[model samples]
Every structure is written in structure tokens, then in C-alpha cells.
Target: MGVGDVSKRILLGRKLRSAQLGETLLPKRIALPVFASDALSSVAYAPDEVFIMLSLAGASYYVWSWKIAIAVAIVMAAVIASYRQTVHAYPSGGGDYEVAQVNLGKTAGTTVASALLVDYILTVAVSISSAAQYAASAVGWLQGHEALFASAMVLLLTASNLRGIRESGSFFAWPTYAFMFAILGMCLFGFFQLVAGTLPDVESADLVISPAPEYEGAVTTLGLLFLLARAFSSGCAALTGVEAISNGVPAFKRPKSRNAATTLLLLGMIAITMMVSIIVLAKKMGLRYVDPREFDRMTYFDGAPLPEDYDQHAVIAQIARAVFLDFSPGFYFVVTVTGIILVLAANTAFNGFPVLGSILAKDGYAPRALGSRGDRLAYSNGILFLAGMAIVLIIAFDAEVTKLIQLYIVGVFISFNLSQLGMIKHWTRELTTERDPDRRGKIYRSRVINAVGLSFTSVVLVVVLITKFLAGAWITILAMLFFFAVMRAIKGHYDKVQLELAADEDDKVLPTRVHAVVLVSKIHKPTLRALAFAKASRPNVLEGIYVATDPVETNRLIDAWDERNLGVPLKVLHSPYRELVRPILQYVAEIRKSNPRGVVAVYIPEYVVGRWWEQLLHNQTALRLKGRLLFSPGVMVTSVPYQLRSSEIAREREEREDFRVRPGDLRRGQVDERRDPGRRG
Candidate 1:
């Protein structure tokens, strides 16, 4: 195999046949981690953002943390209930976009798609950036280079995903479960300590929180309501990755919708429990948090300013350290798994974005390239595109989770609201025709669940836009608009081209005659081969044409042609400006104009070289002539390849490993046992 091919195989494992796609479907155990990690990982930062927003009104407002968490949990539960109906109704894995389009209208569907697309990109950026921050806190040496670390992690995730969903899901499944256990275990132990009257304060408990200047005197006033709204909106980030499960139904094993709905229920219950427990634990332990950018506001209990270089740990880090005070290993384990899961959280977006992109492409709303699977049966183009956009965002924000978080929830909420509304419409439409009492009752219940979900999400959407528009949510809105416009333009272009390409009766008829012209560089083997191939085609007329950049070479060619007693006439067009492409184009145009109803065939000889560098040494003139001849009407340009000796290298590489054995393929029924090429004859 070529070096590039070998490298790709090593990185992405192996190329699977399209028929083997069934083997890549995930069971519930693996699907949970693959699609739910993003929502679960939000526990690492969503609570922190809530505290940061509340800190604007000082430590007194920290009491609202648990309340906001409960509100978020209620919204999440409704979302899960709503999506169960969605999965059962739309098992094709179009998720919110499909639901909105089919029930609402094309406009609503495209808007939801654009919203989901933007949110998916932000999920990767925010999750990776948060992980990088945790890495810096754990290892002091990585403090200033979080952006580089985060970008590297994005690339690593891209390579894993390029291997296909099943492989990458197995790779990430452990860390996700570990993260779940770590947080839940920590919470359970903390609650045990509280009951035993031994719960201790976190490391930041004693720091005095200084309220922001504008809100310093507003704690007892109406401004507190506005501040609480901001905090609640930030806490709602836990809902970011919930829609992924609904979008990923097709990736599940048999009974795809049931398994996906089960996964969503498990995700919602686990996420809600962990998020609420952390917020309550942080409150009971008197943990104080402020924006790292506003570190000056944090002070020692004695009214002394904290050190400029003081490192502020994330909420999970502080809780881990205090909960496992004596057991250093437990603390380290929690910290380690938390960071790893944060990085793997982006894997959720990795899977969702590519599948959704393929759907969009198939619908003609995106470029056709996104619809074609690579040799591995994965949407490789979509994966690379997601990684690249995430990297740009990471670099732009300098891997600051606090800054990236502001732009996060708007898109997710937009999709959530629209999706819930779509489900309501779907059930209403179904109820109109169903006469059976049992099915009608079931539809009634599903509709009510979606109605509740729509109400919750609509409220959350309004709060998000009101509180976050100026902060960074405006950027996401603009991004959604940009994607919407681009998709519409792509669909328009595809429609136009489709109409133009529709064949008519005239397209099926053969041309009256064929006039063949062979471009000869000299009286040599390649020229002779081109002439022989042209004659074999049995054209009505045939001639040899040459572009003369030099008179001496042109005269020598004429003498050589006459010496060979060739019956075909040779014509040389002089190029006073020494331009090869222009002279050849003029000659082809004349032939096409003279016989308007006939076809003019121009054959050019090209060298096929094996090595990359050898290709640059030949075929420059032939390539230029073909480029110009293609646009001329009724003109057919053909390349007659003459293989050089080095071309044998490519042939050898192709034969050396013509058949590869992908482990487990045969046993899984993905490969035929008797036709296995790796077996001994």
C-alpha cells in the first residue's frame, strides 16, 4: 500500500464494506455514553456558571442555587418525556429537524436545523475548553497553553470518530461511566457526611465575595429578580446535549426507538440527580465562586486581597478535594475522570453533527459530498468539518469556558422549543384520523406531555434571549442565520442544476458524424499510439494537429511525418506569441463551427507516472489543451494514457495487500467466511 494509505489504515483502523453497517449499531449500554456524555459532562461547568451569575449579587444569593437547579431539572424531565414521543414517531433519526419540517413547515424545519447545527459546534468548543481549564488546574505546567491542549484533544476525537461510531463509542464508554460514578459517589458520600454531622466546608468557603459595583446595593430591591433570571438561564445549560439521543435513533440496535427513549430517560434522571446534588452540596458547604476574570472581587476573610496568581478550581474539583480530604486517590480519580469525560463530551456532538449533516445533504440542503460515506461507512467529511469549526472557536476564545458558555444555550433552547412544538403538531395531526379508543388515548397523553415540554422550553428560550443576547448569545443567533441562508442557497443551486440536467428526447439520439483530431508532439510512440486509437474508432474524418512554438521543430516534425509514409495529413498552427493552449483552442473551435451537427473528438496523449513528483515532469501541454477544449460545444476531449516505467510501483502497491482481514468482521457476519482473503489456501 502507499504510505498515505498505510497511515490512514493505522489511524482509522480499516475500511468496511457498506453492507457491514449493521455490525456498527450500538446496544443501549454503549449508546448511553455515546449520546449522553455531553449532558452529563455539563455538570462540570453548568453549576459553576450559575454560581458565577449569582455571585454578581454576592454570597447572599447563593441560596437560590438549588432552586434554579430544580427548575432546570423540571425542564429537562419534560424534554425527555417529549423526546420519547419523538423517537417513537420518527425513527429515521432526523430528530428535531425532521419533526419540525414534517409537522410545522419547511421554514421551521430549516430554522431548527440551523439552530441544532450551531449548538452542536458550540458543544464541542465549550466542552473541550472546560476540559482544558481542568487540565491546567490539575497540572500547573499546562496553565497558559489551554488552547493548544484543547485543540489537540479535538484532533484526537476527530481521528477516533473517523473510525466510525461503534469503535469510537466503545473507546469513550468507560470514561463516561466513570464520570457518572465519580460524581454520584461523591454526592452520596457528601450527603452521608451531612447526616453524620461531619460535613466540612470547601476550600473557598471562607473567602468574602464582593458583589459587582452595579448590583452592590440591589440585593433587597427588584433587581434581584433579574439577577436570578440570569442565573437560571445559565443553569439550564444541562439541557444542551439531551436532543442528541433523539437524533441518534438510527444508530441503535433493533427496536431503535425504544432503546433511544430508554437512553434518554436514563440520561435525564442521572443528569438531574447529579446536577441538583452538586448545587445543594456546594451551597451546604458554603462554596463561593466568582468569574476568574473578576478575581479581584474575591478576598480573604480578614478583608485582605487574594494573591494575583491564586488558581481557582472548578466546582467539581473543589467538591472532590473536600469530600475526599484524607483519601488523595479518590480526589485524584474524580479529577482525572472529570477532565477525561469533559473531553469525550464533544464525542456526542461528533456523532450527532455528522449524521445530521448526511441527512441534510441527502435532502439537497447541503453539498452532496457530505452524503457519501467513506470506505469505513462513516461520514468522514462531516467529522472533519465539525472538528475544524470547533478548533477555530477554541482558538478565537482562547479556550476560556466562561466566555464560550455565554454563546452555548441559545441554539439548544431554540431547537428544543421548536422540536417540542413540532411534536405537539404531529400528535394533533395523528389524533384527527385515529378512531380506536386505545390509540386515541395514547396520542392524547403524548400530546399533553409535548404541550408541557413546549411550555417549559418556550419560557426558557425567552429567558435565554433576554438575559444572554448582549453577552454572547447574539453571536449564535447570527451564526444560525448564516447557516440557514447558506443551506437555502445550496438547495436552490441543486434544484436549478437538477432541472437543467433533466434529459430530453434529443439527448438520446446519436450525432450525425465524428471528426477526430489527434495532437502530436512529435513522430514518436505516444503520437503513433494516439493515431492508432483514433483510427480504430472509425471516424468519418481524421487528421493530426500540432501547435508550433518554434519553426525549426515544426519543420522537423513535417519531414519526419512524410518519411514515415503516413496517409493522414499533419497540420501545424503557428503561435507567434508562443502560446500552446490558445492555438489548439482556435483549431478545435474551427472544426466545431464547420460541422455544427457533428462531434469533434480531440485525443491528447498523457503520461501516467507512479511517483507524485514524476507527474509534474510530463503532460503540462496536454492538460492545458484539455481544459480549454472542454467548454467548447459538441467537442469531446479524451486523454490517452501512456504508462511510464515507474507506474509499476503503483501497480505493485495495489496488489501487495489487495485483501485485508478486519478482526471480528467474519464472526459478526459482516464478511463471508469462505471468501475471507486472509485465510490460508
Candidate 2:
């Protein structure tokens, strides 16, 4: 094998065959973390966002934090319940895109696709940025290097995901489960302390919170309602990954829909439990989370505003510290797992985006490369594309969760509303074809659930637009529109190409004449092989064409051509500038101009080297020539590969590698059999 191949296998592990796809189907334990980590991990930051938004209206608004959490939980439940219906009905892994496409028509489907794509990108960015914040809070050296750390985390997640989904799930499941246990345990312990009248105050509880300038003055009822809406919108970040389960239904084991629905219920219950617990514990511990930039205006108990550089711990971190005051290891464990799970939260997007992208590619709305599986049977290209976009966002926003969160939930809610509406339409359509009373009743019940979800999500979408459009959501909207336009343009291009290339009676007619030209540099074995292959085609006319840049080599070539008595006549084209490709292209263009209806075939000899670098050293001229000749009408370019002795090394290495056990072999029932070709029984 080549060095590149070996390095890839080492990094991404071995390739899996198409038959091994079933081996990658995730069980409930692993699939929960794979598809729901993002939603579940949001408890770490969703509360922080709620508190931050509430702090804008002064600490007086802190009482509404739980209310907002409750509202978000309700919306999450409705969305989850609605998606359970989706998985059972659609079960094709298209999720929102398919539902909207099958029910709401193509425009709505494209809209959902664009929104979901944008949301997936934002999920990776926001989750990694939050994880970087947690890292900086724990490790002093990482404080100023957040963007670098976040970008590195993105790369790390990308590499892990490229290995395969099931592998990534196994790698990430421990941290996700540990994070859940740590937070839940901390909440339980914190409540125990509260009941015992021994609960300790948070580190920031000593500081007083002063409202922003607008809220510091008189706060009217309308102003209060607006603040609550903003908080509710921000808290909705918890629901970002809920739809991922529906999108990934196909990745589950047998009875895929039931498994996906069960996972969805578990994801919703766990996320809601952790989120509500964090909010409650934050309230009980007197924890305050605000954008640190606002610290400059906030006052302390001594009636002085905090300095700009005063470090602010996250809501979960403050609660952890307060809850585990006597146990430092517990504090570290909670903090560590929170940070790890926050990073793995991006894995949800890593799993969801590529599957949706593959669907879009199948529908011709995305590039066809996204539809291809890598060596590990994973969507490696889509994973890398997501990572690149996320890294760009992390660097652009400097890895600040507050800045990224403003752009997070808009797309998700947009998809949620459209998907719920599509489900309503889907149920309505199904009722038309249904005759059984029990099935009709079930459809009616599902329709009611979807209608409720649509109503709630529609309100959230409006709130998100109103509260966040000026903050940063406008950029997300523009991005969605850009993606929509790009997809439409790509679809148009594919459609046009398909129409132009459609087979018909006119394409069946043969050309009137064929003029074959053999591309030669020297009369060596490669040249002789090319000439012989061109002659074997039995064209109406054949000629040996050589581009002469030096007089000495041109004369020697002519003498050798005569000595060899090559059956074809030799034609030499002289170039004064020593340019190889342009002169050859000009010659081919002239040949085509002479016979418009005739076919001109140009045969070029290419060396097939085992190593990648050896190829770079050899095919520079031939590649350039072929590239330019492709644009000329009535001309066909063909390469005759001449294998070198080094190729045998690669071939033998491949044979040996092919017989070896690969990843997922056991799960796929791949039994290894070694048969000796040298032995005859």
C-alpha cells in the first residue's frame, strides 16, 4: 500500500464493505448519545443563556428563569412527540426534509433543508465554543486560547466521526452518560443540602447584579414581556438537537421506528430533567450567569461595578462548586464531564448533518460527493465540510458562546414549525386512504399532537426572529437563503445536464469518419504501445503527432521513426516558446475545424506509478494537454496506462490487505478464509 493509504487507514481505521452497513446500526444505549448528545448537553449552557437574558432586565427577572425553562421543556416535549409520529410514518431518515417534501411540496422541503443545514452548522459551532469556555474555566492556560482550542476540538471530532458513526458513538457514549449522571447527582445532592438547611451559596452570590441601562430605569409591563420572550427564545437552545433523532431513524437497529421513538422519549426526559434541575439548583444556590462584558455595569455588595476582567463561571460550574463544596473530586468530575459532553454534543450535528446532506444529494439539491460513503461507511466528506464551517465560525466569533447562541435556535425552530406542519398534512393525507377505524383514530390523535407542536413552534419561531434578528439571527437567515439559492442553482445545473445528455435516436448515429492521432514525445515503449493501441482501433486515418520544441530531438525522432518503420506517418508541430499544452491544444482545435462532422481521437500514453509522488513527477504535461483538449469540439482524449514494476508492490500489498480482517467484520459475519493460490487440491 502507498504511504497515503496506510496513513489514512491508521487514522480512520479499516474500510467496511457495503454489506457491513447493518453492523453500524446503533442500539438504544449508544444511539441515545450519538443522536441526542447535543440536546442533552445543552443543559450546561441553556440555563446560562436564560440567566444571561434575564440579567439584562436586572436580577429581579431571575424568577422567570424557571418559567422559561418550563416553557422550553414543554416545547421540547411537543416537538419530541411530534417527531415520534414522524419516525413511524417516514422512517426513511429524511426527517424534516422528507416530511415537508412529501406533504408541503418542493419549496417547503427546500426551505426546511436549508434551515436544517444552517442549524447543524450552528450546533457544532455553539457546542464546541461552549466546551472551550468550560475548558478555559478549568485549565488556566486555555483561557486566552479559546478559538484555538475550539478549532482543535472541531478537528478532533471530525477525525473521530470519519471513523464511522457506531465507533464515534461508542467513543462518546461514556462521556455523555457520565455527564448525565454527574449533573443529576449534583442536583440530587444540592437538593438534599437544601432540605437539610445546609446549602451553600454560589461563588458569585456575594455580588449584586445591576440591570442594563434600559432596564435600570422603570420597567414597564410590555418591557417585562419582551424580556421574558427573549429569555424563552434563548432557553430554547435546548431543543436544537431534538429533531436529530427523527433524522437518524434509519441508523437504528431492528424495528427502527420504535427504537428511534424510544430514544427520543429518553432524550427528551433526560434533557428536560437536567435542564429543569440546573435551573432549580441555580435558583437555590443563588447562582448568577451573565455576559461578563455586562460585569462592567454590574455592582458588588460594596456598591461598586465589577472590573472588566473579572472571571465569570458558567451556571452549571457555579452550581457544581456550590453543591460539591466539601468534595473537590466531585466538583472536578462534574466540571470535567460537562466540558467533555459539551464537545461531544457537537457529535449530534456530526451524525445528523451528513445523513441529511446525503439525502439532499440524492435529491440533487447538494453536490453528489456528499452522497458517497467513505472507507468506514461514514459520510466523511460531509463531516469534513461541517467541521470546516464550524471552525470558520469558531474563529470568526472568537469562540464566544453568547455570540454564537444568538444564531443557534432560529434555524432549528424554523425547521420545527415547518416539519410539524408537514406532519399535520401527512396525517391528513393518510386519513384519506385509511379504512380501519383504529388506524383512523390514531391518525387523528397524531394530527392533534402535530397541530399543537406546530402552534408552539410557530410562536417560538416568531419570538426568535423578533428577539434575535438584530443580535445575529439575520446572518443565519441570510445564510439559509444563500444555501437555498445555491441548492436551487445546483439542481438546475444537474437537470440541465441530464436533459442535454439524455439518450435518443439522434445519439445512435455513427460519425462519418474517424481521424486518430497518437501523442508522442519519444519513440519508447510507452509511445509504441500508444501507437499500436491507436492502430488497433482501425480508424479511417492514423498519424503519429509530436510537438517539437528542440531541433536536435525533432531530427533524432524523425530518424528513429524511419528506422523503426512505424506504419503510421509522422507529423511534427514546431513550437518556439517551448510550450507543450497550448500548441497541442491549438493543433487539436485545427484538426477539429477541418472536419466538423468527423471524430478526432487523441491517444496519450500515461505512466501508472505505485506511489502518489511518483505520479506528480510524471503526468504534468499529459494532464495539461488532456485538460485543454477536452474543451475542443469533435475530439476525444484517451489515456493508455503503462504500469511500472513498482505497481506490482502495490498490487500484492492490496491482495494481502484485502484478505485481512477489517473493522465491523465480526458484526457483518465476515469469516476470514485463506486460500493458497500456489496449492492445488
Candidate 3:
């Protein structure tokens, strides 16, 4: 093992074998938080977004806050009911993409997949950015550095997820539960105060909202309807993580579908309850909020402008401050948990995206590397890719949740509408084929449920498109289109390669003969080894080839070769330009072009160095020659490694690290794995 391997082992912990994959599967207790945090955490910001959208028309529109919340809750319920059918019907964990593909068509499936992929990336960005804002608000030192803070959070999440699902789930489960309890407790206490007719006003309740510039005059009916639609669409952020459970059904333990469906139910109930409670409580307490950027929109009741430095707290912060005025710890605890849950909310996307990527890879829609599990039985490549993309977005937007939020939920609702439609198709097809009346009746019911889901989601998707397309949602659509094109291109390339690589009778035929050529730059040990290896192959003809650019050096090599009386003949290909790879490639190409039926075996000796930096000093020519020769027709390139004295350093380090690197390991059929722990290398 090298230093990198040692560091990876330390960072990701001990590796787990493929057989231990079952251990990584989560029970319902753990699955709920691991997959539901994204939706649940939306309570911290979704209501605020709704209030922000409504505040555009002034606080007069605040009366519609709870109404929009109820509307969102209804949509979420329909989605949950629809996904319950999905979990029961297509529980292989492809989620919406699988449902859409199997029931609708390839194009529809690809579109849904592209949408979900972009949404998952945005989920990480939005959640981590929101968390960074909360952290900055709590810790003054963290201000003005949320972009770097969010990026660091992304890296940490990537590392944790690379360790395997069960480990990360266990680590994140508590914080999610704490968030749930703290938020519910705060809401319940707020309600209790409301019922007692003693609810305190929020910190910003005394402030008045100035109507947006466009709405400062008499607002038409169309304009009011548009404002309400925007608020509803913004509140729909609560539904972002709902489909994650369906996509992650396979990650659940025994009775996976049932556990997943149950988890979905719990997520929907909790998220909707919390979201509605927050909105209703905010209204009851007269929480006044406007765009933080438009500070002029907020003023005192006397029509005086609020101070420039007036800190407008978040909806949750205002609610917590109002509800826990006497007990400071309660306010701090709720605030702390909200921030923590926002960070953990991104874990839902981390889990969903990798599983979806793995499925896409298996279907040839993504790179095959995504389908391969790492030493820890996790989709490490997908995790790393998601982290990198999310970091790019975080840095690009400067970790501003408000800015990133504009690009959110559009992808999710697109998938939602498609998935629900796909489910309706799925159950209808089942009704046609399913003979048992009981199952058919169940299918009819599920079809109706999916139809209801489709109707609700379709409306939400349209609202989102109309309300947000100009407000950054266009970027999300463009990203989805880009992913769709890339996935199709990938699948097309894979299909082409698959067809070309499939074995035929012609592929089994052996070469007529083998002409071995050893690449010799000097009479050194590496060159000698290459010559010996080439001779041992017992080819039809063998020769030592050299590129000669200087007459004196060529004569010296010819005289030395004659003095050594070596049996093999030396052929020098003179290059006037002193080019190494081009001359050798031309020589091999001529031989291969002449004898198309025979194989020209080019053995290039390379130095195996212990240290990574030492590699740059050696094997430059051999690397280039092998790279070119391997691509030529009727040519086979073999690497003959000459171990240097410093290579003992690698051997000793690997030995101490319980790793072994045998020369010609592949040719000797050595499997790279551990004996005791059974790790796959």
C-alpha cells in the first residue's frame, strides 16, 4: 500500500466485503431519517419561502399562507399514496426513472432520470447552503464564508457516505430525530400558547411590508392569482425529498417495500404537519418577512424605514424566539437542531443519487464505474461525483440559499408528474393482465390513487414552471436537458461497443505467427530483460530494435553488439528528427501492414519506481511507444518491468501495510485482496 491507500483506509475505515452488503441495509428506524431528512428539513425554509413569495404583494397576502400550506400538504399526500403503489409495484429501487421507462417509454424514462439527477444535485446545494446560513447566523465568525463552509460540508458528507450506507445512516439518524422532536415540540408549544390566547408576537411582527414595485398600485385579479400560485409553488419545496424513499427501497431490510412505504408515510405526515404548523403559527403570530435583499420593503408602523443593519431572522428563528422567550435553551436547541437537520437533509440526496446512478450505469445509461461497489460496498464513484458537482454549485452561488432555492423543486416536480403518470399506466396494464379479481380491484384503486397524484403533481409542475422559469428555474431545465443528452450519448456509445465486442467465430482464430521485437535504448539491465523475455517467447522471428539519431552512438552500439556476439540481430531505425515514438510506430506499422495475418509482439521494458515522483524521471519513451503500438493493427504490446533499487522502499511499505505488489502480478493470475478481512481491491 502507498501513502494514499493508508490515508484512504484511515478516512473511510476498514473495508467491507461484498458479502457484507446486507449488513449495510437499513431497518425502518434508521431508514426514515436517512431518506426523509430532506423533506423534513424543508420545514425550516419552505414556509419562509412561501412567506417571501407572498410578501411581494404586501402582508395583506399573508392570509393565504396557511391556505398554500394546506394545498402543498394535499399534493404531498397524493404523492405519498402514489409512491406506496410504486414501492409495491416496482421495488427494485429505480424509483421514478424505472417506473417511467417500464411503463411509458425510453424517452420518458430518460427525461425523468435527467430531472431527478439535476434535482438531487440541487438538493445537496440548497440544503448545505441553508445550513451554512444558519451556521453563520449563529456563529458571527462564520459570516461571509458560507461558500467555503458549505463546500467543506459537502466534502465531509462525501467522505461519510463513502464509508457505506449503514455507517452514514447510523451517524445521521440521531440528528434527524432530534430535529423532528425539537421542531414538533416548538410547534406544539406555539399552538398551546395560541389556544390559551397568550401567543406572543414575533420579533418582526411590528414591522409592515411595502408592496413590491409592480404591485404597489391596484392589483388585477390575474396578478393576485399569479402571486398566490408563486407562493404555493415555493412552498412545494417541502416535497423535494419524498421520492428518495421510493428510489431507496432496495436499501431497506426485509420486507423492503413495506418498510420503505411505511417510511414514506412517516415522512409525508411529519413534513406536512411541520410545514403546515409553521405557516399557521407564523400567521397567528404575525411574522413579517421580506426579501433580505430588499430591505426597503420592510418599515415600522409609522412609515419609517427600518435600520440598514436590522437583522431579519428566518421564519423558524422568529417562531422559536417568540415561543421560547423565557427559556433561552429551548430557542437555542431548536435553532441548533434546525441547522443540523438542514445539513443532514443533503444526506437524502447523497443516498438517492448514488443508487440511481448505479442503476443507470447497469442499464448502460451511465459509466460502468458507477455500478461497481467500492471496498466498503458503497458507490464511491457516484458519491465523489455528486460531491464535486454540488461543491461547484455552492461555490458558484456563494452558498446563498435564497439564490440556490430558485433552482430547486422544478426537477423534483417534473419527476413527480412523470412518475405518477407512469404509475397510472403501470396499474392499468396490471388490470388488463391480472386475472384475480381481488388483485384487479387493488390495481383499480391504485390506478385511481395514481391518477389523483398525477393530477395534483401536474398542476404543481405547471405552476412551478410558470412562476419560476424566469426566476432561475430555466437553469434547472437546461441542466436536465444536458444530462438527458449525455446519458443518451453514453448509452449509445455503450451499445456500439457492446455490439463490436461481442465474440464471433472469427475472433477465436489464433494468429498465423508471432514476430517478437524488443525495444532497446541501451545495453542496460531493463533492455537485457526485455531481450530475454522476447527470446523466451520463441517467436517465428526476433530482433532488437533501436532508434538511432547519431552516427557515433549507432557505431558504438553496433561495435558493442558485435563484440558481445549476441545471437539476436540488431535493427536500427534511423530518425533524422530524433523522434522516438513516431519512428518506432512507423516501423511497427510497416511490419503489421505487411503481415496482417501475423501478430507483432512489442516488448517494452519499463522501470518500476517506489516513489510516485520518481516515475516522472523514467519510462517516458517506453510509455509513449506502448501507447501507440497497442492501438495498431496486428500488434500486441507487453510491459516488461525492471524493478529499481529504490523499489524496495515500495515493497517494504506495502509489506508493513499488509499489501503486496508482485511483479507481473496479472500474468501470474494474482488476485488483489486481503486474506484475513476479505476486502476487494
TM-score of each: 0.96, 0.97, 0.94
Residue pairs in candidate 2 whose N, alpha carbon or C atoms collide under 3 angstroms: none
The parts of candidate 1 lying over 4 Å away from their true place are 508-512, 659-681
Candidate with best TM-score: 2
lDDT of 1 by residue, 433-464 (tens): 99999999999999999999999999999999
- lDDT tens string, model 2, 251-309? 99989999999999999899999999889888877776678667765668899877767
Query: Per-residue lDDT of 1-681 in model 3, one digit per residue for the tens?
Result: 767887998899777756668989999999999999999999989999999999999998899998999999999999999999999998999999999999889999999999999999999999999999999998989989999999999999999999999999999999999999999999999999999999999999999998999999888999999999999999999999999999999999989999999999999889988999999999999999988899898899999998876788899999999999999999999999999999999999999999999999999999999988998998999999999999999999999988999999999998998899888888877777889988888888999999999999999999999999999999999999999999999999999999999999999898988988988887888988888888888999899998999989989988888888879999999999988899888888888888899999998889999888899999887777777776787888999999998898788776655555345545634435533335554
Candidate 2 least-lDDT 10 residues? 672-681
Model 3 off-target regions past 4 Å?
508-512, 550-553, 645-656, 659-681
Report lDDT (Cα) of residue 317, candidate 1.
Answer: 87
How many residue pairs of model 3 clash at the backbone?
Answer: 0
Candidate 2 is scored at a TM of: 0.97
Q: Give the TM-score of candidate 1.
A: 0.96
Residue pairs clashing in model 1 are: none
Better of 2 and 3 by lDDT: 3
Error of 1 at 254 (Å): 0.6
The global Cα lDDT (0 to 1) of model 2 is: 0.90
